[model samples]
Target: MLPPLSEKELDRLEDLLITYGNDYSVLNLAELNGFFTALASSPTTVMPEQWLPAVAGGKVPKFKKPAHEEAYTALMLRYASQVAEELGDDVDHFEPLFEESEGEEGSVIIMEEWCFGYMRGTQVAGWAELPPEQDQLLKAISLHGLEDNFELLDQMSEADIQACVPQVTEAARRLYRYHRLQD
Candidate 1:
């Protein structure tokens, strides 16, 4: 199995995205990882060319540092491998982007981004004629992306929001599995 992403790696990636002047959205490494996994699971064939532009939030800005670009490429390649392994069910280890350090509010933000990225990836991948159930799941995820949960965040207790994390993560996983099953 491939190793999990280190905090340093995520920090480096974030720095690279900033240097590249990301303007489309605020996406963390975890979200990117989720996006790539969704792309891999998608029924449509997605090329690196398509993914690069989509993740760049529409444009692929030139990297300020050549080394950072190379690192980013390597990381993407790893994500690709992860998709393959996941589809085969040959790997079991996985980590959601949000963990303990992110806390409830941070977790909500990251998960929303992650779902948004997955939705974007599926669209870019040209996912075709999804099964009814999967299509419904896609719609739900899209809603999650568009919803202004921040205001609600205050109304809900931290523990209550955090409690929803597992369910949200499971939904993503189920969506991923649903696509694979259709294959």
Candidate 2:
């Protein structure tokens, strides 16, 4: 699997998003990664148009310097492409953007953020109604986002969730594949 985003790269993108506006206040490096990854996985090829609003909170900022805009576009594409490549592989290996934290609570929080990002993805992609099968995954993401996985965490121990990380990653790949085959 390709190495995940480095701290420096994440910090740079995070700062750039912050500059855009408060709409991005809820987003972070991992959520951004999740959003772009979801978009890349979709059948649609429209990147900047959809991505700008999603990442920038529905408004693309006019950077004083053109390099900032160019750089952001390039990085976002690069990261999403990375996720697409990894998911496209035949192996059953996939990693979520969030790293494991110290305790179950930390991991729960990370899943909450990831789910929230994925939920945002469903909206920004304009996928109002997914197929029943794919919609199942979308619904799970929505439920997790709404509940923030706290309920799930309460029901299942962190180790249980941790053990299922591979499953979650695989589900993401399935979501990608499902959309990639859509009309």
RMSD values, in order shown: 3.9, 4.1
Query: lDDT tens digits, residues 39-133, model 1?
Result: 76776667788788777778776777788789877766665666556545632344445534555355333356666666677778877876787
Candidate 1 overall Cα lDDT vs. reference?
A: 0.64
User: Quick one: how many clashes does candidate 2 have?
Assistant: 0
User: How many clashes in each structure?
Assistant: 0, 0
Q: How far in Å is the alpha carbon of 92 misplaced in model 1?
A: 7.3
- Compare the candidates by lDDT and give the number of the best one: 2
The Cα local distance difference test for each model comes to: 0.64, 0.65
What ranges in model 1 sit over 4 Å off? 1-7, 83-95, 99-110, 147-163
Q: Tell me the tens digit of each residue's lDDT in model 2 across 66-136.
A: 99988777666666767667666642466667644666355343565666676677667766577788777
TM-score, per-candidate, Cα-based: 0.73, 0.73
Off by over 4 Å in 2: 1-7, 24-26, 62-65, 104-109, 147-167, 181-183
